[model samples]
Target: MVLRSTRLRLHVGVSRVHRWLALIIGVQLLLWFASGLIMSVLPIDRVRGERLVERVSPATLDQARPRAPLDLVLREANKPAREVRYRLLLGREVAEVELADGAVVLQDAETGKRIPPLNAAMARAVAVQAYRGVAPTPSIRAILTASTEYRAILPAWRVDFPDRDATRIYVAQNSGRIVAVRNGTWRLYDFFWGLHIMDWKNHEDFNTPWLIGFAAGGLALAIAGSALLYFRWPRKRRRNK
Candidate 1:
């Protein structure tokens, strides 16, 4: 009798929600599982156009030159920034400035002028950073934006540069050699960063809290609908053979 009763209950209680629940849970689980799998997968060195620079030896303290002061660089930027930090490495003698807007400039020690910059025709060579179209406020903003380049982050470290790249230079701090100097093209660095901030699957972005909240609303509606169906609605059954 108890077995018969239990069978009767299970027959009535088995639900469409449970049927679909497996599907929903499976999909969510797959996403989380994929995220885990993505991490466990080997870290790839080669990114589309850009190649990762191999780490080089840092110079000894005596060999590295003294770094220019934060005050001097801040003055050079000449803008109200969100933040600034600088580290002087005597070993490398390169001044590395990382701005919030993501401008990295390595300056010469003695002159404090920008090093590894593309030389323009006559007067505006120093300000050629604008033409790259990467900087939100490039050096040429004085001409283009009619204002100084907006700076958000100042360079964090200054190492020495042994030489400059005539057209391009994104050098490594330790070795003071170009890690990625511009030959001509941007190499499309911005698109990669955009991918990082935005999720890979959908460009629209469910990672955004607002979208999550919308999803939660749908979840609430589903729960409420299920509760109403379970308790408030009566089940009427026809006799089976």
Candidate 2:
């Protein structure tokens, strides 16, 4: 009789813990399921803004065009170049020189004249050429710091298009390269991704303390519920002869 009482008390104690854990961890579990379902339903290409924008092909270098020798251009720059690349920027051939100090210098390939950093107008032009959607004149702004939406490069241009998707394109200021394309679809997907990962801010980190604590609680709940089930299940009684 004492053993049976001890078992009943143990069952009650485990049941209480299980209920508390369920109350605490149930909401997050639902959020995880909902976010996962939404993400799976959304097409990945639209989320990446692939249909809204097209990649700008690399400009072909014209050998027939009269251009200054690379050696002469490097000598005049007088900077220790970690790397150098030649590309056409808006029909003008230019040499992009990356210095040891991580600064990028653009020089005219024909005249070797130093090109200044891209201004707002130049950034807008780049964004326009890369964008495939038919939208009105886009609002241009400079993103000087890293953000959750645009994190690829610093000092980039954010060209906002007034379209259905609210498309935004990011262009690297120095390289004249389209870095990232973001739209309303991508934003929605990212929001759900943040919820799934339990990272409300930044939306990148998945190893937060909140996630860890909830995972531990969920495991405890499972164990306690299993114990309760084992104790409560009815056993077959022996027949009286």
Candidate 3:
């Protein structure tokens, strides 16, 4: 009976230690958890912080090895822009700056829309990114912020008067017209996404210690806990009676 009582005390002692460790480390883990939860709830626009606008889609392209020349692309793109802002080297995409409006245009070389087929090995993703535009390629493919124009919060702001064109515009490189503009809800969404993309800062601070510290700590905690569980925890000395 005495031996059994001693064994019972040992078990109770281990259980008490386990609870104490859980309380201390569990609180720290909870902090990380709470921060992560808050981060998750942070609004996308708040995270994006900017109405990032860039010309990502292509104008006109073919999969043919020897793609049509610039002149041919321009001709197919029809009207010309004052500036052909930037060209995407991968996946057929082009941007044109309209000569008259000084607006940007994005077109798919193949589809002439803002987005192209996903180059995933097995399957092809559809083009929901293909929307009207000075702001083309509205896929979650990437976050965008613009310089020439502004993104307004409408429906949210201009509840009485909803003007789509005034919010966000996607210009066609060839035509220079506001092909697709999202002033109200569209603008709101893009702006939100921009925030979600590093609060739309688009700077070099992505890797700063301030940002990575929490993640690194969490990683360390996870690794340490795993090691303890595998090797050390089970063998820990029992608490003093």
Candidate 4:
């Protein structure tokens, strides 16, 4: 009789513990489920703005243009260039030279003059090349400072398209590299991603204190539930028999 009483007490204790833990961890579990479902359904390419923006083909250098001698251009620079390559910049053939200090310079192959950095018009033209015929006139906004989207790459250009998704592409000023591409779908995905990871600040870290606590609570709840089942199921079967 004492053993039976002890078993009943243990069963009630585990049941109460399971109920309390379920109340605590159930909401987070639902959030995890919802966020995961949303992420799984959305197409990744559309979220990345890949469908909205096309890659610009490398501009071909005109072989017919009479270029300045490499030896003369090097002498004009008065320093040994680490690397030199001929490429078309803003429809002009130029020698892209990397100096010892990792600085990139563009020297006009025809006149042997130092080509200036791309201006607004030049930047616009470069951005226009990165799209299909649908958005020939995307609003190009220049951001010299770091922004939320173009955080690391500063002095970049934001090329905004008027597509249904409102796609935006980031282009670097110095290298003209397409740094990032994002859209409305990407923003929605990012929102749920933050919730899923439990990191609202950086939206990347998953080892937060809140998540750890919830995980521990959930684990405890699962164990308690299993214990309750183990104690209750046999008793119900025996009562039926």
Best by TM-score: 2
For candidate 4, give the lDDT. 0.77
Residues 1-241, candidate 4: write the lDDT tens digits.
Answer: 9999999899999989999888878988899899999999999987877776665556787767798998867766567789887876656677877777776666788777777665666776766677653754778878888644557566777878787777777776665656788889998999899888788777777899988988888889889988988997754335555
Q: Can you give the TM-score per candidate against the true fold?
A: 0.35, 0.85, 0.28, 0.74
* Rank by TM-score (best first): 2, 4, 1, 3
Candidate 4 ranges beyond 4 A from true positions? 56-118, 144-148, 235-241
Residue 26, model 2: Cα distance from true site in angstroms: 1.3
The candidate, 1 or 4, that scores higher on TM-score is 4
Q: Residue 232, candidate 1: how far off, in angstroms?
A: 24
Off by over 4 Å in 2: 1-3, 63-67, 73-78, 232-237
Residue pairs whose backbone atoms clash in candidate 2? none
What's model 4's TM-score?
0.74
Q: Which ten residues in a row have the lowest lDDT in candidate 1?
A: 141-150
lDDT of 1 by residue, 1-241 (tens): 9997875565455444545544544454454456445533523333211232222333343335565666776666554444543323322244555556656565544445455532222113222221232323212111112111111122211111122211332323222332332321222232332243334433334476643543554475467457546654667989998
Model 2: ten consecutive residues of lowest lDDT: 50-59
lDDT of 4 at 141: 79
User: Using lDDT as the measure, which candidate wins?
Assistant: 2
Per-residue C-alpha lDDT of model 3 across residues 148-176, encoded as one tens digit per residue? 23332111111111223343334322332
User: How many clashes does each candidate structure show, in the order listed?
Assistant: 19, 0, 37, 0
